[model samples]
Target: MSPHPALSEEERARIDYLVPMDHPFDFRPAPEVPRYPETVRRNALSNHPLLRREAARHHQLPPDLVARLAADDDLGVRGLLAQNHPDTPAPHLLRSFLEYTGPERSHLTSRPNFPTEGAGRLRRPRGP
Candidate 1:
């Protein structure tokens, strides 16, 4: 049996409001959300619609949630934290690109995660 009830068309449309076309919503709540006694957390944050979106916003994020996301097992979740974290190491940010292959990595790379002093080099050349 599926863990979550089937999402209605309305819910699916609502999700569309949050993410653009071509973004996949084939995700479900991770078992950890319910605290299954025997299972260790895996991709818990990544599967959550709320968590990933909130991480993307990078605004008014609480430290506890950020820490949880940073330590999340899923590379996507960790990548989001790295992108949003105010102090992600440059080495770590670059490494995430190699380790996690997906739109999430692309999104993070577009942000300001490079080495503090090296970020300028990564930016596009100013228009003439």
Candidate 2:
């Protein structure tokens, strides 16, 4: 037998507040104070997905950090980079478009660098 069979409503609400599935994008303005390069780099490498997502949302991230977040395994991190970061590479945007099925996925297709051409090559032929 388990000690706790299910989460209480309050616990569920708290979890949802911490990580809302419907609203994946964090639009709150980042701090105006300049962050040190090392701090930015550390955030990029943090094990916590929320921290990585924040790093991806920063407007002035170096190209290397943008690339690092674009390649992060977490879908939220990569999606945020593709949606918010101006310097995000086109390949990363394409990968995010293919992988992320969130509500904002349609918005990704409208990004300036998202690859609209060559998608036909990704389709597999039906087996006879």
Candidate 3:
């Protein structure tokens, strides 16, 4: 979240109507959200979760941006990298990020990824 007013109240309100999807679930009439200023729209477009997710999928996303997205508050955004993004975070970093999630979110990290033997590790609590 911006500590400064990067978004006006009207622009901020528009963001509430926009939904970032991992995949489309249902179709609906696009809501009539207010338009944002060009600067706001450009900034929003660059950081849009869909864009971020796709960027995170690439091994070439700039390291700084990858690092920034690693700390993104949105779990899905975080998962986009944490779950084997080629330059996927190390096991320790994955633990640090995914630990915030419950079992339901584990599938994202539970792929044949991580430094573990199988996806089974994610479905069960880590052993001591």
Candidate 4:
């Protein structure tokens, strides 16, 4: 039903845009994202999803960021970081997982790829 008797096709199109569409999904690819250099891109450590995902994909991210993500509040994000980060300290990460509590601990520990350096260290037990 048209809202106005005198509405033209263009006006009707404008009104359609104002009204929410029944289908909320956007199938179109995002337009023109700018490219950043590796140095500038390191700032993506902030918690935005797109930035974080982009940072996770960035090959030049530092080892420190990878190590820091072990304590990230978001387990899934942490897991992604763990999986993607290069040169992660295997023993340190496992120790951090042992220290983690609640759901984060459970999620991190459950990963099959979680570094086993700590386990290897424990098995060797020191002489008195």
Winning model by lDDT: 2
- Cα deviation of 40 in candidate 3 (Å)? 17
lDDT of 2 at 124: 64
Q: Candidate 2 or 4, higher TM-score?
A: 2
Between the candidate structures 3 and 4, which one is better when assessed by TM-score?
3
lDDT for each residue of candidate 2 in 9-125, tens digit (9 for 90 to 100): 344334533433455653335568866767667668765566677678777788888878887877888888888776678899889878877767767767778786896665568
TM-score of each: 0.38, 0.65, 0.44, 0.38
In candidate 4, position 81 carries an lDDT of 51
* Model 3: per-residue Cα lDDT over 1-128, one tens digit each: 32124655555545644445444211122226633344333432354554444444443445666667677655555665555344545663455344545333544444334556554555657699
For model 2, give the RMSD to the true fold. Answer: 9.0
lDDT of candidate 1 over 1-128, digit per residue (tens): 11122543344444533323344312232333333321212223345444354453353345566556655555555565565556555566676656665555555565465655655565569998
Candidate 4 residues 1-128, lDDT tens each? 33343554455445532322232211122225634655224434543333344454443456666655545554434444544444445554465455433333444444455565545653446899
What lDDT would each prediction earn against the true structure? 0.48, 0.70, 0.48, 0.44
Stretches of candidate 3 off by over 4 Å are 1-13, 18-47, 91-93, 96-113, 116-128
Ranking by lDDT: 2, 1, 3, 4
- What TM-score does prediction 1 earn? 0.38
